[model samples]
Target: MHNTRSSRGIQDLVDLFDCFIVDQFGVLHDGMRPYPGAVDALVMLKRAGKTILVLSNSGRRSAPNEQRLLRLGFQIGSWDYFLSSGEVAWKRLDRLLRERGGAEPLKCLLLARGGDRSAVEGLPLEIVDSGADADIVLLSGSMGDRFDMDHYRRLLEPAAARNVTCICTNPDKIMLTEVGPRFGAGRIAEVYAEMGAPVMRIGKPFPEIYQIAVEMLGHPPAIRTACVGDSIEHDIAGGRRAGLPTVLVGTGILDTLSRAEKAELFRRHGAAPDYFLPAFTW
Candidate 1:
């Protein structure tokens, strides 16, 4: 059903790719801390004359994200452009709300910490009580840390009953954090979906975000681009959807998938990436 090809390594895809769409979590660093050699891979790629376009689903604001990277001993450089799903959600919401010409502001039930709410700045959203439910559900990160699962499970019910539009700002299932691996927004979204609620994704695996990222390059299409990330479902799938070659970083899910499973996933969605690496290059 899909045109999939199995390549041996990164070198296989390097030839045709100029820009890279990199996932932040499992590929770059975890939520709590930065992973080893991740920055080096970025620097190496930049030095090689390829345009580096960082794409991430991190729900935290750019300020906090940079600070987190710095404190975690990762070299974030002086300035780098990262397009987060939060930013995407805000823009889409803003545009949609404006186009509707409805003075009634959009209500948001943020599924993340208040700190992460910085991404929603300037948006006309009423961040009300999670239990009360809102017109739309904006899931940035996870409420698992600050709130209880039972609470989340409870929150899902009212939102579903009201037929609130569910929007997952990030499509990440798990992140490698300083405190070890942890669940992401996609995990919560899945839980909501199980209750027969609607969920829309704004980040990876969706065409919208990457479409904007590529345009930021200011270069014509087919400029030799590559997508590198840890998750096959999101990052790899996004690259496939974008029609760019991709690199599967294995440090996160490699041990979990057998050779057959990985092969099948790669081939199931269009041609498999031109290359596969154990993790981000170093």
Candidate 2:
């Protein structure tokens, strides 16, 4: 059993934590805009000298995510650092290619929103039009707006047939879109995995991304750090794995869930947050 406490806002738990590893899409903003009082909550944290790190499962690089936040009215000094799964994966891929010492560039079948190639922009990779000719499948983003799951399945069937490995930077199963929630890249990666292709997920609920985020915060004590997000599978589980307390915010994914439904979800995911907030207010 988990001892989950209800928090009115960030203020209730301000003195309990020195650092905060916050999720972007759900906790801070939806896909299109910042949640009500989200920006002010961040500003309050900064004013209280709390270390704030916006950690996101976005498949886009850090710069693009940062630009989006800025456009959404997030000030530059609201957080101490920002890290994205795509940025981390890109750095690792770049390092591996450098160590290979002049090998042929790998052919990549890239999937992203609006044909965005920022995830692999500077990597030594050749973007192939067909999965049959690619060495690896890079599942960076989802185009659920234009393509449906059937289309994604058709696109990955050829690659799955060849047993090509897929690297999924964003492991979010559901994405909060302007219209509503949609299946995310992680769900697409699951489809490929179901078709017998190997999928390597690199994001929340995984250790590497959390380890990297903690390091970025100067290795603060785990007890003094808390992970805030709206998902149990990603945020709560990931925070537990990283040895930090977790806070569940109701501004995003948990907004529509009833109290009973939320409890069922906690049982289903086998993870519960240490604290729950009605919203991201300070």
TM agreement with the true structure for every prediction: 0.83, 0.98
Instruction: Give one digit per residue, the lDDT tens place, for model 1 in 179-266.
Output: 5456678888888888888989888888988888888876446547777877778888888788777777666755377778877776
**Candidate 1 deviation (Cα RMSD):** 3.5
Candidate-wise lDDT, in order: 0.70, 0.91
TM-score of 1: 0.83
Model 1 local distance difference test score: 0.70
Candidate 2 lDDT by residue in tens digits, 1-282: 258999889999999999999999988988788888999999999999999999999899999999999999998889989999999999988898899888899999999877778899888899998988989999999877667899999888999999999999999988887678888999999999999989999999999999999999999999999999999889999899889999999878788988888888899888889999988899
Off by over 4 Å in 1: 1-16, 61-64, 76-80, 99-102, 131-133, 145-149, 178-180, 267-271
Per-residue error (Å), model 2, residue 104: 1.7
Q: Any runs in candidate 2 off by more than 4 Å, and if so which?
A: none
